[model samples]
Target: MITDIRLRSQQLVNPAFNDPKELVAWMGALQGQEYSMAKWAVGLRLKKPDIRKVEAALEKGEILRTHVLRPTWHLVVAEDIRWMLKLSVRRVKLAYDSYWKNHGISEELHIKSLDVIVRALEGNRYLTRQEIGEELSRAGVIVGDDLVGYFLGRAEVDSIICNGVDKGNKRTYALLDERVPPMKELHKEEALAKLAIKYFRSHSPASLQDFIWWSGLSITEAKQAVGLIDAELIKERIGETDWLIHHSCARNVRAKRVIHLLPSYDEYLISYKDRSMALAPEYYRKAFNTFGIFYPVILHNGKIVGNWNKSAKQKQFGVESSFFIPGIEVDEGELDKAKERFRVFNKGGND
Candidate 1:
């Protein structure tokens, strides 16, 4: 079970990267539904984790956030964006079909919007969502509040626009081609194989169902992709359930009684259809809710024993937790270390 924890969360051998881009590249994509938490998700995997540095990487175009895989924001490396889109764009488009229909986002509108957005963001300029909406309206496309977001989200999924540097505190969009250098696109088979391998390597001891849920690939496609990477993956039968893990993952490491302040929508929790391995069924409601909200979790030795929240203002950080597994003794020192980690992340420094 402990081996399950280390490998599934990419902690095998405990390697740490200095660059957020490298981490995103290796992990394939980090869920970006909660943007700030997504930054910390990548930060926690790096040696010197800091929110500001991850934001710097985003500004430098080392990594890009866009609507990719599963019709949500995912932080993907610039070099892989083209091939990733080639792999998942059709699926994402299909997922949004109903919204497109209800909002009258016809093919013509998509095409026209693309042209308008391209012209508006030409010369490597960035534009906020509101600015883009106004530009669309000026072009005779009345994008109401709801449609405005749908338009931008559709545009992003279509690979026309991507995250630009933050203008003040508001996020801006840039032409994907301008922000990301072109990379040779991979053939569908090769792309599927590569994505499967990356996912298995980073988030293994997971089932094909988990891959389907995380990648938004159909079960048939998931099986095909997994088949392509069979040589690199090892299968284990834990109880009645079968799991796939990377061949190189260490299986001998003992799970220490450690604590981790996993951020909201952490990949450790979100990258699977089944979370029973990491979360106890009895405490599920406290950490996860019906509204698709995943709160910050308190992980004690790879299992979610509770949920935690932090309040940070200026340089001060305060953390509070509610434990589900009552009477479980967590050393006070361990709690302090967890609080300090959150402090460093919140303060954006060791201080």
Candidate 2:
């Protein structure tokens, strides 16, 4: 029942969004470190999944990929980025403090690097990481691959720069102000409430701990956030656990036989600290590795049934599946439909 609610909440079943931008805004943010797979993650949630449409949203600046929520890359809507960053930047920086110190990125150096980066990207020019690193070197700032990555990430969290249109397959950075128009800024309290509402509205039947994990808020702050939105959410106790479901999602969602080829780090599994609702404990190791890497998964009726991999051969795209339970009964019609949906999302060729 929880999984059914999650399926509807996550838009994996009975998807209600027609536009990719609307969908991203609805989900708050999607894990997007894996560029290609993250596109499919958005596509799979559409009423009509279209990879081109998702990419268009990113290119047109309707949605932006940046470091937020946690220290990892997430795709957030352009309008929400400012307030979201303001709410989470300090926590994100705290998480990365040690790395910065170890890399000799003192406050002065951080300021200097941001200044150089802002100058380099001020004129609507998009620079790849290599190009940005070269600019830093030209400015007499010591630069390396790792240091460049840190500098760019720092710039992103500071709202100094953001993702620009890709150069072929390479990612580029653009001035955040240039890429996105000015938007209203929310105060800290308003931002926290908004974030809590967004997370629960899109990921309901989640616990306070799940919210804390996904939002990167400390336990005290996370609890305060939930309290700010307590009246709007419905608490349901399942066994010994208390789960919070948004009022809008507090209804029975009929379960159906649906197959989903969820990408690695999809919110369905990753957003929550405990994944037992969708992933069985016995199969945890198979779905995730020791290093916190989640593999692409096959979900049948809201439960992870197997794992899958994508392949391309001479422009032809294919999906290979490995079932956890051999000889498991599956509806061939549904499975074929799921694979066909993926093929269409892949544009019938390797991307």
Candidate 3:
């Protein structure tokens, strides 16, 4: 229980640091599969909650969202994107090989598609996914319905492109080099050590297995990486489980009495291989569905005690929640405070 408290505190929700780019860099990569919610994930860590601040950072090219770990979209800073892609994209590419092969996407076609995309997105231009697909079609490259997303994902995995600003409701793509300033690449071992340090420091009280699961690195490779950073880390035994945390992380912590409305797919829940510490095992099915859809959760003092959802009606915000902690009296004031945080976040602070 003390371990869980310290781990949540390490998430830096108070945002003693404010820059979204710095926050993203510190965490290595934030799970960004759900674009809008991902923005809120970044927002939740800020001293003043505002989702638009994250969006503004995206527009200014301070950060780049691309396919990094696990072949899913992640919000990563410009400086770290290259080395991070170099470290993890190979495993992702190998995993996606069968999907690409099934769609008749050949090496020649992939190269041709990249060339077309590069030419189309040159000169600081940002093209929508549909626009990029249209450009490929005009070039005699067949990007079928299913092939469109796979092809674009390949461009990101290959580090040729990344998500840019939004075009109305649609997302646009930009040449990564044009958006992000040039950064020196790191050697493989150095890169591994850096990544290990970042992950543990930002998401501490984690295990080697958790790092492997989050990074898509093999157990051997993960072990080697963590070994490189051993001097900077502290190991602890919580029950029978051995956890690795940064030496600087909080110890001698007590369970927090605060409540947090954590977004779906937030790194706190998704970054670990085992969630039994933050989420009770029996209630996992209640918070998440069998199809892997994680609803927004009401986190009370580091434990996921319930799931919550919100809606907007005529500019009025409403938050609905269900707590799993039995016989606990409902504190409307506390619930309202949690709701206000989300209210400000969702409204982008206009409220």
Scored by lDDT, the top model is 2
Q: Put down candidate 1 lDDT per residue, 132-212, tens digits, no spaces.
A: 999999999987877777778877888888999899989899998888877887888898998998898888778888899
The lDDT of each candidate is 0.81, 0.89, 0.81
Candidate 2 residues 126-153, lDDT tens each? 9999999999999999889988999899
- Lowest lDDT block of 10, candidate 1: 4-13
TM-scores for the candidates: 0.94, 0.96, 0.94
lDDT of candidate 3 over 1-351, digit per residue (tens): 444534454463345557787778788889887888788788877777787778889998887889997878788888889899989888888877776677666888878888999999999888898898899899999767567777788888888888887898899998888888789989989999988988888888888999998888888889999999999988888787788888867666664466778788888888887988778788888667788787788777677788787764666678888888787565678778988988888787887
Model 1 spans with C-alpha error above 4 angstroms: 2-9, 312-315
In model 2, what are the clashing residue pairs, if there are any?
none
Taking every candidate in turn, the Cα RMSD to the unseen true structure, in Å, is 1.9, 1.8, 1.8
Error of 3 at 73 (Å): 1.2
Pick out the ten consecutive residues of candidate 3 with the lowest summed lDDT.
Answer: 5-14
Which residue runs does candidate 3 get wrong by more than 4 Å?
Answer: 1-9, 12-14, 312-315
How many collisions per candidate?
0, 0, 0
